[model samples]
Target: MKIDREKLHSPFVEQVERVSGEVFANCYQCGNCTGGCPVSFAMDYGPSQIIRLLQLGQEQLVATANSMWLCVGCLQCYSRCPKGVSAASILEALRQMTLRKGEDHEDVGGLPFPFLKDAPQQAIISGFRKFVS
Candidate 1:
């Protein structure tokens, strides 16, 4: 986690803000979002950590992480955020950014059909909508 501050600039951070309309910088690294996230155990970084990374100007690191897909549009983080940061929407925006570039962070294509066959309909649709080329 050695961030070369000189290399920190715009691009991804600006897009996150522009897309999610959430000022992630206002986040105070509180654990509320992470504690409230139902899928935090499966995520490499939780909702609060995501905001922390964004605030630290590690937008690319956050964007490339697999944690974004773990948010199943659950608004618990958003609801619990004292700073009004929409953590779910920010993750959604990351997914949107990845999708817009014809890429996927979750690698759904790597999973076999049978592995995903029993997945919920909502999850399948959401995955497709976010990852399909």
Candidate 2:
């Protein structure tokens, strides 16, 4: 629960700031993102919590959280946020950080749904391949 901010370093934070400075920096921990998140029940840390963690440079929490990969990218929290924080985009950035660090979700991989078989999954996979390749 405690982040050693001195240890955190990454260029991706700059990318997040560039793309979502208003929303990412304006978060007041109102928990609105978590309240509006349709998939909060399925996440280890809700959307707002992730943002708070990231703000504190808690890269371990963000990198290790399985919820980063669980995000459906529905953008519900982004659309509903009063602060205009794109919760979904924040989740995506966390997911990218996790992947860049080689964090893997073995449990998610064992799920019955084949990511390639689902259209949304396919789209995500395609996008990831494009971005990470």
Candidate 3:
């Protein structure tokens, strides 16, 4: 499918840029992000592809991609990037964007609570209370 680079001027694109900045612009698709990604095997499109799709304003496809939600936030891609691009953190910000849009995810087969599940219940409850406050 053809991607319209012009559509990248949309508000959603701006949101991505505001958070990620020129890191997205520096990506050369070297596949280092994908190679360093621990969960790339489970991702429909690797980290570099996601950045490309975002640059092309493929918002719908990006929002629906399961890879965004599957990222383990290991920072491997971020640390290994030759361009010093924080692809892992960028995926996180993108995931937040996806969730903020109230998009529905069909690929709900991964972990139940990505962040909270890793922490103790007391810590989780404390966080819940903080949110409720």
Which candidate comes out best when scored by TM-score?
1
The whole-model lDDT of each prediction reads 0.81, 0.69, 0.73
Q: Residue 38 in candidate 1 has what lDDT?
A: 94
Q: Residue 22 in candidate 3 has what lDDT?
A: 43
Which residue pairs in candidate 1 collide?
A: none
Q: Quote the lDDT for 98 in model 1.
A: 79
Tell me which residue pairs clash in candidate 2.
none
* lDDT against true structure, model 1: 0.81
Candidate 3 per-residue lDDT over residues 1-133, each given as its tens digit: 5666567766777787777654567888898989989899999888888888877888777766778667877889888889988877777677666656655343234426766568788965643432222
The residue-by-residue lDDT of candidate 2 on 1-133, one tens digit each, is 6556463334545555555443456898888888988889888899888887667777667666766667777888888788888878777765565556665544444545665466586776665553441
Error of 1 at 88 (Å): 0.5
Q: Tell me the deviation in Å of residue 123 in model 2.
A: 8.7
TM-score of each: 0.81, 0.67, 0.72
> Tens digits of per-residue lDDT for model 1 on 28-103?
8878988998999999889888887887788667876788876888799989988888899988888888788887
Give me the candidate number with maximum lDDT: 1
Regions of candidate 1 where Cα sits further than 4 Å from its true position: 4-8, 105-123
- Report how far residue 48 has shifted in candidate 3, in Å: 0.8
The per-residue C-alpha lDDT of model 1 at residue 106 equals 58
Which of 1 and 2 is ahead in lDDT?
A: 1
Name the weakest run of 10 consecutive residues (lDDT summed) in model 2. 5-14
